[model samples]
Target: MNPTPATSLSALREVLPQLAHPDGSPVRALVVDDEPMLADLVSMGLSLCGWEVRVAHAGRAAVEAARGFVPDVLVLDWMLPELDGIEVLAKVRSFRPGIPALMLTARDSVDDRIRGLAAGGDDYVTKPFSLEEVLIRLHRLVQRTGVMALDADELVVGDLSLNVRTREVSRGGEAIELTTTQFNLLQYLMENPRAVLSKAQILDHVWDYDFGGQANIVELYISYLRKRIDAGRVPMIHTVRGAGYVIRPA
Candidate 1:
């Protein structure tokens, strides 16, 4: 049973609730895929995540969409008619310079991946992929680019600061060592400061929808974050008992 656009979007929201940006606007995305079903599916999923998505089935259409849509991220398919993915990426970057793009292809070779990155893609995904993987990668790209930021390079809660550009975390002017996962988790929490986010919400943003391991993984990571970000400090990260966690200046 194939899902209709409405149903697909609804399922996506059930798994990963889509919250509006801090500024109350949807993040915009440009999805370029030749296959109608795949493109529609991806678009619907993104839309469910509060992203304003525009679909382009061809390389030329993708380039055109970038001009008008001005998306924060671009999900491009490698094989396309009228200018391959690489060429389309080149043109888009020429004007939009540094706009993050995730290239999707059936090409799984190391050399192919390198070429895609060298040709101006921030990330690459091979076909037979999970929609969750795509969404996660897109989130990472957006975070790294500060696409959701409200015109700021730093997100601060209390004395803690997460530098969107340098990818640095510091509390009370002291550098805090964090792994990539820890950094991402902390960033998510700090981005929505004072908001009580549920465990499911944390997992959806920090981990993936298909995380088949222990359900305590979110708790484990929260502990990991506390150790680094809250251990010796004033403890900005707090457990809300029945609710999830929230980062607020204590």
Candidate 2:
């Protein structure tokens, strides 16, 4: 007899331990696709891999979700009803510049892939992709971004100070402690201060991958940093509408 839904859920839970973060937080992902069945399939597969997944059917909805849901990775389709994947990515980058975004599309030409990457895609997966490959790539991206050790040397943006190696952050002389992911994400932003970097660009440089996961991960970490580093303080990380992020002194 086939297992009941509860039994299947329990079985899935048992496997979650193997895929969960060391601290037990569920990895989060967003899926954007115009095709309902394809989006469902992608969400289900990612859920099976222990990701908390959400789906959006249009580019505009995807952008709105990126701001609120703040997923760690985005599985985005190249074509959409209104804005298209490129437009969605551009908008997401404006709010949270360093999120990791994976592009999914039926277009397989080299030029098309280049265009996607140039438009803020960390990675691209063509249609008819293997589920296993997607899982592996996503796993690699999450592990790399979420688990890196930062340098303890101090980083300065005018009077603001951030120590990547020690996970200590401060403005002027006051000190702060940041989560591992937050520290790394902030360090990357500060390191490239004054330069506008999109979420995909951040993922490519900091996470050191071409693609695999949700772009909103950058936004989530940025939120963490804002609370820890910029909250109650003058804003330094500024958003450029329809562009990306730039860190500049107030």
Highest lDDT: give the candidate number. 1
Q: Candidate 1, which segments miss by more than 4 Å at Cα?
A: 1-22, 149-250
> Against the unseen true structure, what C-alpha lDDT does each candidate score?
0.79, 0.73
Mind giving the per-residue lDDT tens digits that candidate 1 earns over 1-250? 1444565445655654343355658788999989999988888778767689999999888898899888878898899999898998899988898778999888889999999998888899998777777877786576554333343667766567788788999877899888998999998887887689988888888886654565598889899999998786677788999988988754
Q: Please, what's the RMSD in Å of model 2?
A: 15.2
Q: What would the per-residue lDDT of candidate 2 be over residues 9-117, giving only the tens digit for each residue? A: 4554454323333244677788999989888877876776557989999988999998999887888998898889989888988888777888989989999999999
Model 2 residue runs over 4 Å out of place are 1-23, 147-250
